[model samples]
Target: MKMLEGKVALVTGGGQGVGQGIALALAAEGAHVAVAGRTLATLEQTCGQITQRGGRALAVTCDVMDAGDIERCVSEVVDTLGGLNILVNNAQIVPLGRILDVTDEEFGKGLDSGPVATLRLMRACYPHLKGDGAVINLASSAAVRWDASGYGHYAATKEAIRALSRGAACEWGPDGIRVNVIAPHALSPGLRGWMEACPEEAAAFVRSIPLGRVGDCEDDIGRTVAFLVSDHARYLTGATIPLDGGQAYWG
Candidate 1:
C-alpha cells in the first residue's frame, strides 16, 4: 500500500519550486493534496501535474499574510479534501540583506510570512489534527550558519519557525500530532537565482557539500517529508532536521 494512502495533505505556497515538488510527492504517495498559493494559475499547474500522475489534488488561492485568507484556506482544505492529515508550510517571503541594512518593513515581511503565518496555520489546523497529524515547517541553513551575512532576516524568521515547531511538538505530541522543521538545501527557485547571479559562489558552495551536489526538490526534500509525516516517523517530533547534504550542523 502507498504510505500516505487516503491521507489529505495541504501544502502552502504549493504553486512552485519546493512547494510544488512537495505537493507532487505527497500526491504520488496517495494523498489528496490541496495546493495553496496566491497565484491560481501556478497552483492549478501543480494540481495538473498531480492529475497527470493519477493523483488527486486541488488548487486553493491564498495570501498567507492575510488572516482571512489563512482561515479560508484551512476551511477549504477541510471541506474539499474531506479531512486534513498533513500540513507542509513551505510559503514565506524571503527577505535578504545584511543585518545593518534591513529595514523595519523588510523585517516585518519576513515575520509575517514565516513564523507568524506558520503559527496561524497551526492554530487553524489544530482541531482537525487532534489525532495522527503531521506538520512540516520549512527552515533554512541560514538559521544556523556562522556567517549569516545577507541572510540575517531570513535566518531570524527560520529560527523562529524552528522554536515554534519545537514548542508545538511538545504541546501537541500527546494529542498524536507531530511538529518538525526542515532546513532544506534543494535547488529551489531562489537557490537557482542565487546560483545564476553568483556562479563562482554557487560552485564553491556545491563543492563544500560532502554530497557534491545540490538536492532535488521532489526526490530529496519532498520524499523526506513524505516519510516524516507517515507512520514511520511517528516516533519523531520536535526536531530540526538539516537536509543540506552533510554541510551544516544544528547545534
Candidate 2:
C-alpha cells in the first residue's frame, strides 16, 4: 500500500523550494496536499504539477507571520481535504546580516515569520491533529552551527523551532501527535544564487559532506520528510533529523 494513502497534508511555503519538494513527495505517496504560501502564482504552479501527476492538491495563499492567515489556511485544509493528518511548517525568510548589521525590525520579522508562525499553526491544528498526526518543522544547519558573516537572525529563529518542536512533542505525544524537526542542506532556487556567487565556499561546503554531494531538494530532504511523517516513523518524536549528507558532523 502507498505510504500516505488517504492522508491529507498541509505544507507551508509549498509554493517553492524545499517546501514544494516535500509537498510533491507527499502527494506522490497518495496524500492530498494543501500547498500554502504568500504567492498565489508559485502555489498554483506547484499544485498544477501535482495535479498533472494525478495527485490531489489545492493552492492556498497564506502569510505565515499573520495568525489570521494561518487560521484560514488550516480551515481551508480541513474543510477541503476533510481533515489534516500532517503539517509541514516550512515557511521562512532568511535575512542575511550580522548581529550588528541586522536591525531590530529584521530580527523581529525573522522570528515572527519562522518559529512564531510555526507555533501558531501548531495551536490552530491541535484539536484536528488527534490520532497519529505529525508536525514537521523545517529547521536549518545554521541552527546547529555558526554562519560567521551573516545569518545570526535566521539561525536564532531556526533554533527556536527546534526547541518548539521538542516541547510540543513532549506535550502532545499523549494525544498521538508526533512533532519533529528536519534540518536540510538542499539545492533550491533560494540557495542557487549564493552557491553561484561563492563557488569556492559552496564547493568546499559540499566536499565536507560524507555523501560527497549536496542534496537535491526533492529526492533527498523531501523523501526524508515523507518517511518521518509516514507509519515507518511512528515511534519517532521530538527528534531532529539532519538530512545534510553528514555535513553537520564534519563541519
Candidate 3:
C-alpha cells in the first residue's frame, strides 16, 4: 500500500511553485489533494495534472490573508474530501525592504500572510488533524543570510512562522499532530527570473552551494515534503529542515 493511501491533504498556494509540487507529490502518494489558492484557474491546472496522473484532486479558491477564507477552505476540504490528514501552509507574500524602510503596510502584509495565516489554518485544521496528521510551514534561507540587508520584514515574518510551528509541535504532540517547517531554495519563478537577468550571478550563486545546484521543485522539495508528512517521519516534529543544497542550513 502507498504511504499516504486514503489520506486527504490541503495545500495552500498550490497553484504554482513549491506548493504545486508538494500537492502533486502528496497525490502521487495516493492522497486525495485539494489545491487551494486565490486563482481558480491555476488551482484547476494543478488538479488537472494530478487527475491526469490517475490521482484524485480538488481545486479550491482561497485567499490566505482572509481569516474567513482560511476557515472556509479548511471546512470545504474536510467536507468534500472526508478528512484532512495533511496541511501545507505554503502561501506568503514576501515584503522586501530594510527594517527602517519597510512601511507599516508592507510589514503588516508580511505578518498577516506569513505567521497569521499559518496559525489560522492550523487552528482551523486542528480538529481533523488530531490523532495523526502533519503540518508543513514554509520558511526561507534568505532570512538567515549573513547580509540580510533588505529582507527584514520577510525574515521577521518567517521567523515568527518557525516559532509558531515549534510551539504547536510541542503543545500538540500529545494529540498526535506533527508540525514542522521547511526552508527551501528551489528554482521558483522569482529565482528563475533573477537567473535569466543575471546568468553569471546565478551561476556564481549555484556554485556557492555545497551541492553545486539549486533544488528541483517537484523532485527535491516535493519528495521531502511527502516524507515529512508521511508516517516514515513519524518521530520527527518541531524541526526546521533546510532543503537548500547544504547552503544556509538551519542547525
Candidate 4:
C-alpha cells in the first residue's frame, strides 16, 4: 500500500523552494496536496506539476502574515481535499541583518511569518486533523548551529518555532497529533540565488559542513518530511530532525 494513500496535506509556502519540494514528495506518495502561498501563480505552478503526475492537488492563495488568510486556507484545503491529515509550516521571512541593525519590524516579520502563522494553522487544522495527523514545522541550520551572524532575527524566529513544535507535540500527543520540526540545509532556489551572488562565501560555507555538500531540496529534505508524516514515524513526536547532511547536530 502507498504510504499516504488516503491522506490530504496542506503545505504553506508550497509555491517554491523547499515547500514545493515537500508538497511534491507528499503527492508522489499518494497524498492529496494543497499548495498554499501568497502568490497564486506559483502555487498553481506547484499544483500543476503534482496534477500532471497523476496526483490530486489544489492551489490556495494564502499570506501567512494574515491570520484570517491562514485560517481560510486551512478550511479551504479540508473542504476541497476531503480532510487535512498533514500540515507543513514551511513559510518564513529571511531577514539578513545584524542583531544591532535589525529593527523591531524586521524581527516582527520573522515572527509573523514563522511561529505566528504556524500557530494559526495548527489551531485551524486541529478540529479536522485527527487520526494520523502530523505537522512539520521548518527551522534552519543557522538557528541550530548558532555559528552564523547577520540573521539573528531569522534565527530567533526559527528557534521559537522549535519551541512551539515541542510544546504542541507534548500537548497534542494525547489526541494522536504529532508535531515536529525540520532544520534543512538544502539547495533551494533562494540558496542558489545567494550562492550566485557570493560564490566564494557559499563555497566556504559548504566546506565548513562535515558532509562538504548541501542537500537536494526534494530528494533530501522533502523525503525526510514525507517519512515523518507517514506511519513509519508514527512513534515520533517533539523531535527536531536536522536534514543538513550532518552539519548541525544537537548532541
> In order, what lDDT does every prediction score?
0.93, 0.90, 0.93, 0.89
Better of 1 and 2 by TM-score: 1
Provide the lDDT at 45 for model 3: 93
Candidate 2 clashes: the total is 0
Ranking by lDDT: 3, 1, 2, 4
- What is the Cα-based lDDT of residue 25 in candidate 4? 94
Residue ranges of candidate 4 with Cα displaced over 4 Å: none
Clash count per candidate? 0, 0, 0, 0
Model 4, residue 167: distance off in Å is 0.6
For model 1, how does the per-residue alpha-carbon lDDT over 1-251 read when each residue is reduced to its tens digit?
99999999999999989999899889989999999989999999999999999999999999999999999999999998899999999999989998789899999999998999999999999999989999999999887788878998998999899989999999999999999989889998888999999999999999999999999999998899999999999999999889889999777
lDDT of 2 by residue, 102-138 (tens): 8888888888999899999999999888998999998
Give the lDDT of residue 246 in candidate 2.
84
lDDT string, candidate 4, 1-251, tens digits: 77899999999999998999999999989999999898999999998999999999999998999988888888888788899899999988877688799888888898898888889899899988876799999887776556667867888888889999999999999998999999888888988999999999999989878888988878888888999999999999999998887877677
TM-score per candidate, in order? 0.98, 0.96, 0.98, 0.96
Task: Output the lDDT of residue 86, model 4.
Answer: 95
TM-score of model 1 (CA atoms): 0.98
lDDT of 3 by residue, 1-251 (tens): 88899999999999988999899999999999999999999999999999999999999999999999999989999999999999999999889988899899989998998999999999999999999999999998877898989987899999999999999999999999999999999887888999999999999999989999999888899999999999999999999999999999455
Native-to-model Cα distance after best TM-score fit, residue 62 in candidate 4, in Å: 0.6
